[model samples]
Target: MEGMDKEPWFFKDLSRLDAIRMLLAPGNTKGSFLIRESESNKGSYTLSVRDLDNNAGDTVKHYKIRNMDKGGFYITARIAFNSLSELVKHYSREADGLCTTLIKPCQTRIPQKPWWQDEWEIPRESLKLERRLGGGAVWRGIYNNHTKVAIKNLKVGTMSTSAFLAEANLMKNLQHPRLVRLYAVVTQEPIYIVTEFMANGSLVDFLKTNERRQHDHKHPHRHGISGKAQTLWLREWRLLKRGITSTGTCGRPTSWCLRTSSARSPTSASLASSRTTSTRREKVLNSPIKWTAPEAINYGTFSIKSDVWSFGILLTETVTYGRIPYPGMTNPEVIQNLERGYRMPRPDDCPEELYSIMNLCWQEAPEKRPTFEYLRSVLEDFFTAQKQQYQTQPC
Candidate 1:
């Protein structure tokens, strides 16, 4: 860490007991944390944090920060970072794992602000509901009698307020052309989330409508695909592949969104994403089972590597035009086949390169799967060349 960055309290030689004592000292609170080189291991580091809220044990706790053999670092297998600074920054923002988030270095006192700021909270009276956007919780609305906005109303009792928008830090830091712009939050009996309105409607409807038109017209290429598989053609899949990783939008394993034409840049696998690590490999607990990787389902081991596996599913869903993955298979059957090294075959008319990429994503061993970074680069090269062949975005 000294050779890397942020060394005000790196403590290269600090012992485990010293770390616990420093974290438990007089003024420290939960989330007060420090990183010290491990005394037991030559080059490894340990994260020590105070957790006064835990009634089970002593106030201070320790976690190991391990280095990935290939590259990056991780506190848990589910999440990884390119550097120690990013690892620190991520946990500081959200305690995705760990006893608590890394608030300030072990001793530094920094005033914390409420996750929701008073300024970001808008009054309900200012919003005028126009019409339902389609279904679900969203609607077209007028904000302050002038601005047209997309409004999403959520029931307060259904989920905790902290659970929904706890990532104020993540939200504030997000600024991208491809992502929908959230305007403000209305905290009332029903929580209203206001965002920029897209005049064309959701991407799903747009794409579906176009697909229906193309199908009705009897486009020759339609013969290759089956059912209502209307979302993507090979050309269109090539166009959207890069945009897939750049946005925070959910993929097929979770939720997929509509696009507004402004696509995104290629980056790490949205696989540079959120995840869970578990020990029960044979059975999946709470996650969407179909999209999960074998390592995660059987052993509870999750990482960006597992995310790569999910990305393969995301890719299949994309190319198949929103078709459910493992088309004819049940969840039990899918899991059984996956355990036997079964990967979905290439979709009809799917390019070999695209399927090859999917195969890389589907590799059974978590460590063997291509990373989001690698996938981003490969997709960019492959799709860019294909896009140049057509010279147009998806219709």
Candidate 2:
């Protein structure tokens, strides 16, 4: 029963043919792929996929649907070619378009090199293991003459080598104060993703620890959030929120981080910052079921809109002092409820404006959810209003 329950309902209930059609649907198509159907002389239907706009040249493939079994269509069987790649090449035709120009890579990204004479390699003896940080483990290490940095050692088997490189490449492009600083990627043996250490630990843990300390205080109000802390929290929140959209780091909740005392100019937190579309997709297949978006769970579709949903949950967790988003609900229960338009209630004392953002994020249709850019503007206004309200108070 346990084994059966873990099985993906997608394979059991949905057929391969139907899934293919769904993938080509208007909502799913991102101009990279297109499917066309026509009638064949032999009474079978012919379907062809036009795969273009990738780094590779244009290609198309045609196949006829003739055989059907309990598992649905045996699509590749009817094609002249043995492999999918071969089939694409058979029917491929030449084309020239504006999109082709747009799809080209701009320039080779140059990552910052280590100042030390010895490349980016970190001596194993220098690393002092601290503790686990989700999928990766962190360690304190020194390089370039006693410069302290955090070393994130991720298991190579966790993902494909290409994915590891993609992540490293993404981090190199993402330069922000609120986001962690990527020093260099050490690819020897187990992958070491080097970054600046946050001595204060993750914001999630920081908040949880603060909540516990406050509860144990002699004077509750005295230990209540100071103005400085409140301001810093809002500022950091804005930075992290903007950084997510700017750098396209919408993978997991842990992707967002903050330094304990470091503060950057508010001008750097503009959500309107333009970003090129990321070619790489943050693989969330193994992520916790709770944090997984509804669309991703049902159809294996993920996008920036889905990230907004996760962000809403993260916001809820932040305001509630690290409380789980759907507390007391199982994964199946959460999915069922979400499909029926169920949304989590606002955390206790959560600001009305922030809760409104949460409601927007939980909209049934992904299109209805506000973009991170939109959220950025709304948050700026929210913070402005908050500061004004505090000023007007009879303090």
Which candidate achieves the best lDDT against the true structure? 1
Q: Which sections of candidate 1 miss by over 4 Å?
A: 1-115, 130-135, 156-158, 167-169, 198-206, 211-287, 391-395
CA shift of 180, model 1, Å: 1.7
Q: Over the stretch 284-391, how does candidate 1's per-residue lDDT look in tens digits? A: 433456777776566555566776676677666545545667888877788889878888888976778778988998887777887566776667666556656445
* lDDT comparing candidate 2 with the true structure: 0.46
Model 2 lDDT per residue over 1-395, tens place: 12422322212232233333333322222223322233333323344333443322223334453434432333455334433233233433322221221111111122345422123334455455555544435677664545566776665454556555555654544333234556656665667767766554555565466544464242222211221232343443433322121112211122233332111111112212313212111222223446556765555555667767766766676566566668999766776787787888877777776788878877778899987667766666676676676667674
What's the count of clashing pairs in each model shown? Answer: 7, 0
Best by TM-score: 2
lDDT of 1: 0.58
TM-score, per-candidate, Cα-based: 0.51, 0.52
